[model samples]
Target: MYGWIWRHLPGNAWLRALISLVLTLAVVYVLFQYVFPWAEPLLPFNDVTVNDQ
Candidate 1:
């Protein structure tokens, strides 16, 4: 999959590396800004319990 993307990206190695970095940052931004917020409530990460006897 990654090899395919690298092949499709325009220009030589330097330009492809820059493009890859930008693409990665964009994906991270989207996940943090939208996807994670939307999905957070459905996940059980915050569901904590404590028991005392």
Candidate 2:
């Protein structure tokens, strides 16, 4: 299955690498901005305290 799909795509090695890098960075950005906050409490010393003047 994987081999057949790769054979159909007409991009060179460098093009494929660039596309994968961009996609990975996009996913990481989304996770850090949204998903990471929800799981912060589960991590040790991850609490963010706010002070009001």
User: What digit string (tens of lDDT, one per residue) describes model 1 on residues 1-53?
Assistant: 99999999999999999999999999999999999999999999899998997
TM-score of candidate 2 relative to the true fold? 0.55
Error of 1 at 11 (Å): 0.4
- The residue-by-residue lDDT of candidate 2 on 1-53, one tens digit each, is 74665565558977776766776799899999989988887787856688998
The CA lDDT at 1 in model 1 is 100
Once model 1 is optimally superposed onto the true structure by TM-score, how far is the C-alpha of residue 25 displaced, in angstroms?
Answer: 0.3
Compute the lDDT of residue 47 as modeled in candidate 2.
62
Q: Please provide TM-scores, in order, for all candidate models, with all chains considered together.
A: 0.94, 0.55
Error of 1 at 31 (Å): 0.4
Instruction: Report lDDT (CA) for all predictions.
Output: 0.99, 0.76
Candidate 1 matches the true fold with a TM-score of 0.94
Segments of candidate 1 deviating more than 4 angstroms: none
Give the clash total for candidate 1.
Answer: 0
